[model samples]
Target: MSLLKGKQLTHYYFNTSNYTKALENISLSVEEGAFISLLGPSGCGKTTLLSILAGIIEPTFGKVTLNEKNVTETQSEMGYMLQQDYLFPWKKIIDNVLIGPKIRKTLDNQTIEKAKQLLKDIGLSSVIDAYPSSLSGGMRQRVALARTLITDPSLLLLDEPFSALDFQTKLKLEDLVSALLKQYHKTSILVTHDIGEAIAMSDQIYVMNANPGRIHQQFEVPIELRQLSPFDARKHAKYQHLFDRIWEELNQLESTSIG
Candidate 1:
């Protein structure tokens, strides 16, 4: 059964007399434990769609059901990683990572032990006491990922989580995030403009178009299951083909927007 479903989602930004359609009839289902990526050109509704699904903002029209429960009126039952690392500067790394559980009042001793285990599992045990300001940009992002996973949500909503990092850091973190998600058996929906990143990280890619934003294409990757890192996925021949196709699609949209 699908873990999450979106039914005929439509969203718009309205003012006194202007109505800008951000999404129209957007619908998709995510299977349990599947890693899905939503790819789109700028001004497309990738973030907006994610927000709607995450219940950060309500859609003008639609329904979002997760694990067979309607949470459109409640706070999302999923963890969210914004484009920027939303870590607290003054909080120690462990404390910052525990924010989710703190808010939900689930940060008990057993959970704190699990939180420590999560940090250790991610190879950040040594930095557990360090503040966010003391860490490198990549380390901060790792902290962000740790923070999100500590909540142990069934679903994860990643909104360009690595957009702020350098290419090398981004690639490395992709491996880290992918492996962690697999280990935790969490289904994830990643929204990104970088087709290469999407191809490297996702089992399926949903291509979207803007200007009354809508899903334009959906591709179930045609590649053998490879037990390799995200860094290794980038080196696959299939990755190149998928990247080229998606790159071309996005470039076309950019050209049209320019003209």
Candidate 2:
């Protein structure tokens, strides 16, 4: 079953000086429990498309749906994680994880315990009471992950959540997130510019084009690669082949755009 669907989405940004059509005729569907990635150049509106699907921005035309209902109507079923951890500096780690439930007035004894377990599951058990400032970059991102999962969102929108961390930390977090999402059977969409990250972490990848950003092509990771963790997937024999293919195409796309 498709957990989330976007149909012919188009979006525009306007100002007193000029208007830009950021996205055009974008249609996508995310199957239940599947992981997908949006890969493209800098100006391709990947974030814009993600925002539209998340209901953070309204499309100029068409619509998005989650579980066959309008996205706006089912907003609570989605969780969005951004490039930054964006945790409250003053709040303790536990309080940060519980913020969502607290904001929605759903926090209770059960919810609190669940948050604690989530933190422990992500290997942050020792710092439950520590402040965000005391944790390393990787650890803080882990806390952010627990926060997103506490509400048990059916679909997760990850917009370059690991981009800011060191390469080693990024790889570790990729493995951690991939395992947790699969364990919970959650559907996810990640927007990233790194082809390797997309191939390592996604079941399917949509390579996009700029100038009225749209999907230029799609690639499916082989079953052998999909079954492995992101780190191991990068070591597979077929990984380099696919990476070269995507690299060439992206270069061609860039040259075309520049011309």
Candidate 3:
């Protein structure tokens, strides 16, 4: 079943001098436990579309539905992880992961214990009580991942969560996140400018065009590639074929924009 659906989503940004159409008639559906990526050039409104789907902002002319109910009518349990960890420097790792439950007033023994297990699963058991400042960039992101998952969200919105890390860290996290999401059976959508990242981590990829951003193409990752971890997927023969195809499409989009 479709866990989340966006119907003809259109969005606009208004300013004192003028208004800009950020997105246009964008429609998409994500199945339960499927992973997808929004791949596009900058200014293509990938983030805008993600925001709308996350219920952080409403579409100017369309509606989003979760589990068949209008998003506005439902309490969205969707988790959002951004490029920056945005962890509270003052809070310990445990406190950082529990922030969501604390804000929702759902914190208790069960939630706290779950948070501990998540930290352990992510290889941060040694630093469960350490502050964010003491952790490395990659470690902080691990905490952020645990924070996002503590609420047990049915869907995860990942906005280039690994972009800020070093290449080695980014690759490791890609494999880690892919495994974790699959283990939990969570539906996820990632927004990234990296074509390789999209192909490596996604079951499906949507390439977007700019100038009133809209979907330009959709490609499904091969079943063999999808079964492997993101790192292993990159080494698959089919990966290069798909990557070149997306590169050509994106190159054409860039040329059109420049012209």
Candidate 4:
């Protein structure tokens, strides 16, 4: 069974004053352990789609299922990483990472050990007691990732998590995230505006258009992570081809209206 499924999903802002058809007839299946990226223009329902899948919001007109069970109202185990790290400055690194487990009431000796292990895996064991401000932008994001992974979520939903980083840092973290996820065999979906980032970080790419926000095309990356970095992928011949195709798809939505 697919790990996550959205069936005939349609979301509309029903208001007599100002109604909005945010999403319509959207459907997709995410298999376990697949690295999928959603590429789209602004207001193309990309973020809305991620929000629904992460259980932050419910679809207005369809069903969302997780592991073959309906999960439209609540999510089971799912980790979400957003554009901002949202780390609390007052909390120490370890404390921040432990927040999820504490809130879930799953914090224990074993879980704490796992958290520490994850920090170590991410090369952050040295700063376990440091505050958020002490960390670099990339380091802060690493802590954010550790905090998310500490919960051992079955799926990861990344909503432009690397968009704010510098060109160099984004490339570095792309590799780091890909490696860590593969090591743990975690399934992930990344929502990004950068087609290069999508091609570099994903096995499958779903290109989206604006307005009603539907998939324009789905393509497979021809290169492997071991063969190219996010930045390096842009230099590959296939990247040129994919970029042109994706740009065309996005450009087609130029005349569409978004609420």
- Give model 1's clash tally: 0
Cα distance off (Å), candidate 3, residue 38: 0.3
Instruction: Give the CA lDDT, 0 to 100, for residue 90 in model 3.
Output: 92
Report the C-alpha lDDT of model 1 over 20-113, residue by residue, as the tens digit.
Answer: 9999999999999999999998789899999998978888898988987875644536889999997999899999999998998877998888
lDDT of 2 at 164: 95
lDDT of each model, Cα atoms only?
Answer: 0.87, 0.94, 0.94, 0.85
Which lDDT tens digits does candidate 3 get at residues 1-259?
Answer: 8989999999999999999999999999999999999999989999999989988898999989989988766544789999899999999999999999998899999999999999999999999999999999999999999999999998899999999999999999999999999999999999999999999999999999997999999999999999999999999999999999999999998998899
Candidate 1 vs. true structure, TM-score: 0.94
Question: Please, what are the lDDT tens digits per residue for candidate 4 over residues 1-117?
Answer: 689998887887777688777788888999998889999877889999899888788788888888877765445488999898999999999999999999988889999899899
- Every model's Cα RMSD, please? 1.8, 0.7, 0.9, 2.4
Stretches of model 2 off by over 4 angstroms after superposition: none
Q: What lDDT tens digits, residue by residue, belong to model 2 across residues 53-99? A: 99999899999999999988877888999999999999999999999
**Candidate 4 lDDT:** 0.85
Taking all chains together, the TM-score of candidate 2 against the true structure is: 0.99
Candidate 4 lDDT score at position 78: 88
Error of 3 at 221 (Å): 0.7
